[model samples]
Target: MTQKSPVESLIQLSAFDPVSREDPHARMKPLREQCPVWRDETAKTWVVSRYADVRAIVSDNTLWRNGINAEEGSFARLLVNQEKLDLPPGERQSILTMDDPDHARIRTPLAKALYARVAKARPKIDAIVKETLDGVAGKKSFDLIEDVAIPIPIITIARILGVDDARLGEFRHWSEGAILALNPVRTPAETAHMEASNAALDAYFTELMAERRAKPQDDLVSDMVALQAAGAPLSDIELKINLLALLIGGNLTTTDLIGNGVRLLLLHPAEREKLAANAALAPQAVEEILRYEGPVDITGRVLSGERELGGCPMHKGQSVMVVLRSANRDPDIFERPDAFDITRKAVPHMSFGGGTHICIGAPLARMEGIAFFSVFFQRFPTLKLVDEAPQWRTLPFFRGLERLMVEV
Candidate 1:
């Protein structure tokens, strides 16, 4: 087997060009076909793109979600160690990243919480959505990320956690800082912000846990504390870790999903027009948005042993970055994968992911997507982009628009 030239860059691409913002599908398509599992020597890791290869790794227990194992590779290691995270990672704290029995124990309670109480919060979610949109309603032009996406998820998640409105901005700040620290281009200043944010939020959650123990309420915090007292428990560390994951992972990603989807519709006016003409097709349109432009472009896994992915051999402890962007556009899975068509009847896109560690917040994300898109179409039938292109976030791991100037 001929060894290909070593991959020199991890995500080596032009930065800050709004043209790339309009579409990333073209950029990821070829890699999915030609190099299903390619290694980046610069990053010192294997990157998988094709649908089959990506799905196998996600489903198979051989590959693990522990980011700590990826430390051996140069670029695979996240700058910040979430293991040292001060706040509980929240939903991400559960067994999603774990292998078996431990994962099952932690996931059981959270899964029940999500399917039951979280589902009931939809009415409250709808109200939050309306209030959020109302804040920017009638404005001639507004930045969608700041004006809409950020506030909605932050408010929604905060309410579920029983976090006070007064502390909402503080939560947003810490969450954003933690998320931003994972970016490939993180600076010293950004690192400082993340540490400070993490420390502050960690202390706050610890106090909240204490308060919940003293006087339990109907909120998730109280539920978790009650579980601990009853001995069906998650450790304080695990609780904090999972809580942070739930809050940051849940809150941040959806913000990007909605923000990116909104940008996509505006960029492709014909698609926007098509959706507007038939309101019932909005759900299908959201699916297309997820497939065409997913919020998370990539996720990493560490190899457990010598294994072959897409015909490439892997050794133990090597990192594999599954490019979700490429998998969604794999030609073998979806015909005309690059084309964003709302009516592409029931395509099984891996945007929410597949297998054991699939996103637990998927149902909630979908509900949020449906609610926002439905209301968006009804409210701003003529919502238009401020320009032909919009400013996208420079953060490499996550894909989203930093700001989209929209005119209602």
Candidate 2:
């Protein structure tokens, strides 16, 4: 086997290199073609980039969700060793991190709550999208990340959980901190902020739970609390953990996904025009956007036992990084994969993932995407980027614009 290049070795360590963040597709394309299951030497883990390999690994239920210590170098060791002090790394993971029966026991009820809330929120989601846009009505230039993308999902999720609207700004701050906490290289200040955010979150949710129990509204939290009282009750810890998951998942992923879509639309005028002309294509465009440049690039999984993926030896307990973004663009799976086409016959993409751990919020995300693009085009027909080159954030796990300066 050939010796790995410096870049490949650096990737292993999960360093936040500017080149990859600015244009990872350029760097990843050649690597994925040459090595489907390549290990990052510095990061000490395997990264699978091909569509077939990534899909197979993700589909296999035997794999455990693994490898949360994202900070690079010795700082990572500090986090792992001090695991007792860590917040529960919540996603779909809060309840389903364990194997089999236990996983199902915890997840079943939570999934029910999520599905019910999504159905109830559909009619009003469109209005929420318009209301967000209205906040910046007549503005010449605005930061899409701050003014629009972040607020929409946070407020929607907050409202669904019956969280106080007055605390919207606080929710945004803590959510951003929690999301940034996913990064390994957080400085002392960032780490402090993250810890404070988690502490505040615990306290806030604790109060909300008390309030819900007292008032007993028809919101999701109230519903869950009521269910517990009648017969099946989620534990206090479980409830708090699940609330964190819903808030973060509901807000962060959709925010980045929406930002990515708007950024792509601006870059590719031809595709944007096609969507503007036919609003019905908004849903397809969202899928294409997800395939072409989804917000989340990769996620980690632990091998349950010795298995060979793409002919590479994957041992039990070894970490595997499923490169969803790279897999979506694999030339083998997608012809002319680089091109963004809304009307192309549906090609299955792993944007929401697959199998047991598939995203639970996919329905809500789709609604938000369609609503945002539909109204975005209609509201700001002549919107154009003030700075054609968007300042993309240097986040390895998350992909999004730091700021989208647009003139309406």
Which model scores highest in TM-score?
2
* Model 1: lDDT of residue 112: 68
Tens-place lDDT digits, model 2, residues 142-227: 88889999888887777778777789889878877766656677899999988888889889988888898899886878878876
Q: Pick out the ten consecutive residues of candidate 2 with the lowest summed lDDT.
A: 69-78
* Number of the top lDDT candidate: 2
- Clashes counted in candidate 1 amount to 18
Question: Model 1, poorest ten-residue lDDT window?
Answer: 12-21
Q: Which stretches of candidate 2 lie over 4 Å from their true place?
A: 1-7, 10-15, 67-81, 85-101
Cα RMSD (angstroms) for every candidate in the order listed: 3.4, 3.4
lDDT of 1 by residue, 1-408 (tens): 134533235564222333334455545555555566788877887877778887887777667666555655545455335655574343334454565556666777766666665778888888989999999897998988988998888777778888877888898888777665446567889988887977787787898999999998778888887877888667776777777767667776888889988888877778878777776777888889888877877766778778876567788878887877778888888899768788889878788776667888888887788778877867888788887566677766567777888888
Tell me how candidate 1 scores on lDDT. Answer: 0.74
